[model samples]
Target: MSTHLCSPQHVLVLNCGSSSLKFAILDATTSDEVISGLAERLGSDTPSIKYKYNGEKQLIELAKGQAHDAAIAELVKLVNELGLADNLIAVGHRVVHGGEHFTESVLIDDNVLTAIEKTAALAPLHNPANLLGIRTAQQAFSTLPQIAVFDTAFHQTMPNIAYLYALPYSLYKEHGVRRYGFHGTSHYYVAGEAAKLLGKEREQTNVISAHLGNGCSVCAIKDGKSVDTSMGLTPLEGLVMGTRSGSIDPGLFTFLTQQLNYSVQEIDDLLNKQSGLLGISELSNDCRTIEEAAVEGHPQANLALDIFCYRLAKQIAAFLVPVQRLDALIFTGGIGENSDIIRDKVITQLGFLGLECDEAANLAARFGKEGLISKGQAHAKAFVIPTNEEWVIANDAARIAKEG
Candidate 1:
């Protein structure tokens, strides 16, 4: 909340993409962001960094376009300019695929870097970018410990029965091909918040949580750990997403190849990039765009919205097998926390156990506000709890820094 000055032990969080990097400095004691920024269009003709510090926003153009190196160099200048670098304790990097090796956050070292590189095969687009950010942060903050927080680590608790696909056991053993769920950090954060709202420890809570954003997934959290999730192997296997096709018939791939002469690479792009809300609505991938179009008598947009709600409700109902006694159904992430319309439609389609969606409560809970979106005295309850994954990363980084 301060403008310029801050105390010690702040955690610097870095979430790096192929061409963009997001950085945040959080007070270790309060989890409040001291400074936050993003760098975009790295390695492009017009790369730029934007940051907020001391209640004012600033922008700088990185003409060199030196990718992560340039962005992090600018970040170092920003931190040093604010005189907050000495107070920083650790840097947290969001690595999307940790495979089975990283069951928890670890202080980055030679072995950790090697392991992250090995897992790059699993997340081709994310892990390499994450590694670049880690190495750059190491250069920028050489003395500070860099911590790797995995997106798949929390779901490592899932029993083999839930994670193992029906495919050959040899494939899993040899190639490490099995269902390793994503969004564990987000799921873990919101589950704890849900437990607090329920007046129970996270270990005693049971709920199904849906994180609806560009990348979507539903997690069945039983006893504070993920038992099952909608996503498998990759994020593309979950409920319909902003641009992904979600779960599709495996035969469709063969069908496309045979009937349309589609290459494997083409199929991958079709399913992972061109499908979902964008493909169905033939307009935009954003929920707001589709919702607005549906209101204006756009049939395709309405159909896309309906399919999203239906499939999401189906997954929620299916997750009941893992979450035997549901405490509350949670909605989080961008769309889940903001779109009252999507929440209402999805809850209505959840036929079993009759979840009463209070229209007023649903509308009131939007825009980052957390509250019960169910009627009073309803048998089943649903809550809109905004997720704070960066908080989790910062806490994990600080704890690891202290431990190391």
Candidate 2:
């Protein structure tokens, strides 16, 4: 039997993004959420931090020009003021890119921090902010050990064939231009949970987990390990996301730069921030907004929604070929959890593969709950499992800390 370390009393989790900080406090023993909230619009005119603890909401108004470090310090202050700091046994930070080095969560040390910094160029928007959260938390909680739980770590199990790019070997050796799938912790958690729901050992299960949020990826889990995933070297090479283009022809970028007089930076901004549902809808990136527009007879909004579901279904089917015998299909993340219509459409396209959606069940599974949403006699299990990436980070951190 695999032994798990005795859980900690409490663990604080931090998810720092380019311009925002989200923090969570968890009761490690029960894996229950104590509180969670976000610091949004960082470095902007109305930079603000909102936190909730013990079922009460609190807001912190920041002066203009608040940096990431300052935002983290403020989060620390709020947690302490709420009297939860006394129970904090260790800190867990979400690091986006671990390159090829970190395969699992590791206790943070000077060397580990340095190694993470060296990989910053791989995830410029995420790694820097993540590093800042780690350092700032270290300074604030000097007596406690901090752990780095990576988003890319869970995907390290991907075989060589699945991770390697067809590009020249020399380029792979010179630069780390290979697939490092993101949303791994979520995929890892949900896949195991799906196996349990199916009354099967995780190691004997085959599942496809779709994590569809602003940033999205579909992971193919075989025997509890990632066999294939939609995301490539970066989060950019996957299904259509809120503002991201997902996957675009490489030749288009070259054509834009050479013929249309666009710079590399301009191309990156256009694809990463000005594309996807927003570009196609010509409205808002929010799915709710797009759905509203579609209801009002907006052809572009309907097209964007259709294309998003079709692409997602197509990719999930592609991953299914490798697993051969898929036991379950799981949908998690912001869009997947709440958007019943989108879930129905995606699953409808997969009916040929013995996937049948129970529309009523899909509509009822919402707000961090898990439920079966496939017809009773369907050959494959379809489920909606709300993901808990922060809890995964905290569990790993607490386990590693206990071991040491």
Among the numbered candidates, top TM-score falls to: 1
Q: Which 10-residue window of candidate 2 scores lowest in summed lDDT?
A: 1-10
lDDT of 1 by residue, 1-404 (tens): 35435567788999999999998999877878888889999999899999987779999999865688988988898888878888889999999999989999999999999999988988898999999999988988999999999999989999999999999899899988999999999999999999999999999999899999999999999999999998988889979999999999999988999999999999999998999999999999999999999999999999999999999999999998988989889999999999999999988887456687899999999889999998756555899999988899999999989988
Q: Which portions of model 1 show Cα errors greater than 4 Å?
A: 1-6
Q: How well does candidate 1 score on lDDT at residue 297? A: 98
Clashes of each: 0, 0
In angstroms, the error of model 2 at 153 is 1.0
* Candidate 2: C-alpha lDDT: 0.88
* Model 2 lDDT tens row, 1-404: 10112334688899998889998888777787887889999988888988776678988898898877778788777767667777778999999999998999999999999989988988998999999889889999998889999889888988889889899987778988899999999999999899889999999999999999988899999888888898888889989999999998899988998999999999999999999999999998999999889989999999999999999999999997778888999999999898888999998999987878887898899887789998967668899999989889888878876887
- Candidate 1, pairs of clashing residues: none
Give the Cα lDDT of each candidate: 0.91, 0.88
